[model samples]
Target: MEDTDFIVNYVKSKLITINLEILIAKDGEDGVRKGQIERPNLIIADLMLPKMDGFEVCQQINSNPKTKDTRIIIMSTRNSKENVLRCYKLGIDDYLIKPFGLDDFEQRITRLLYS
Candidate 1:
């Protein structure tokens, strides 16, 4: 779901303490495919992904019956009003701008996973 290794590693580092299984998808298509199969409780995706964008990724996963309940958090550097509003309209649970802090990230994850 995440495009860069740094963010992925950061996510892993943060999520490790929570004991959640992590899955990596190389691209948007891969993310959708894996989500259909794994149906994880939550998904965190980057906006400017290769092969497909975050918006499409959210659409496909949200539309799929198997993964419809999966909580999604969209991450992007561009926190435009349009982008954030679009993500919300697509039924994404939350959105995060890039360079977010560990505490904020953890809080959001906990909220989505537990709420």
Candidate 2:
């Protein structure tokens, strides 16, 4: 799977600098559970994960009445056309490939959060 400590820390720092609240999940299951409980505005997830993969997590979140409207961004190394298409079909707001630039990532976050 996906190891997201760095990504989480990076995003967390950026969000914190902007005075935004951030929550980090331990794994895919944790992510879904937290999403349901926290009802956050956005969720950035990795495609590969323990317990459950990101696709399942996304499906669960999308299927839930409480979190169906939540915006999702898939941040992963899986950059195949099929993967991107699948994410869009699942209604994900955006898909970011691995090793993304911080500025681009921040811009996407800003656009989603503000626009």
Candidate 3:
């Protein structure tokens, strides 16, 4: 989940009946830590995280054998080609721009999970 409480709660509410167990990370470091321990099938992260940015979080997760295969979806307000390309290069499965609609996010998640 993202660092902001509002975003996290909003996402959780939108996915209320999705049958997926959701976990929240306090920041990038916690995200990486939880990824290693929980080994979730998917991860949704924000670009501007405290302590470490999303890029570093991606590197940590990707490099770690325990969580390297986890699907990642990065959300950011940057909307820059370079950032998106960088995330792809880091093996993220999807990238979402900030202010994205919940329906669109759901569609992306569905595609990522079922495709």
- TM-score winner among the candidates? 1
Tens-digit lDDT string for candidate 2 (1-115): 1456777887777778777788888889999999999999999899998888889988999999999998899989899999999988888999999888877888898899899
- In candidate 3, position 29 carries an lDDT of 94
Clashing pairs in 2: none
- Model 3 spans with C-alpha error above 4 angstroms: none
Q: Give the C-alpha lDDT of model 3.
A: 0.90
In order, candidate lDDTs are 0.92, 0.87, 0.90
Question: Clash pairs of candidate 3?
Answer: none
Clash pairs (backbone) in predicted model 1: none
Q: Considering TM-score, where higher is better, how would the candidates rank from best to worst?
A: 1, 3, 2
Question: Which parts of model 2 are misplaced by more than 4 Å?
Answer: none
RMSD after Cα superposition, model 3: 1.0
User: How many clashing pairs in candidate 3?
Assistant: 0
The local distance difference test score of model 2 is: 0.87
Greater lDDT among 1 and 3 belongs to 1
RMSD of each: 0.7, 1.6, 1.0
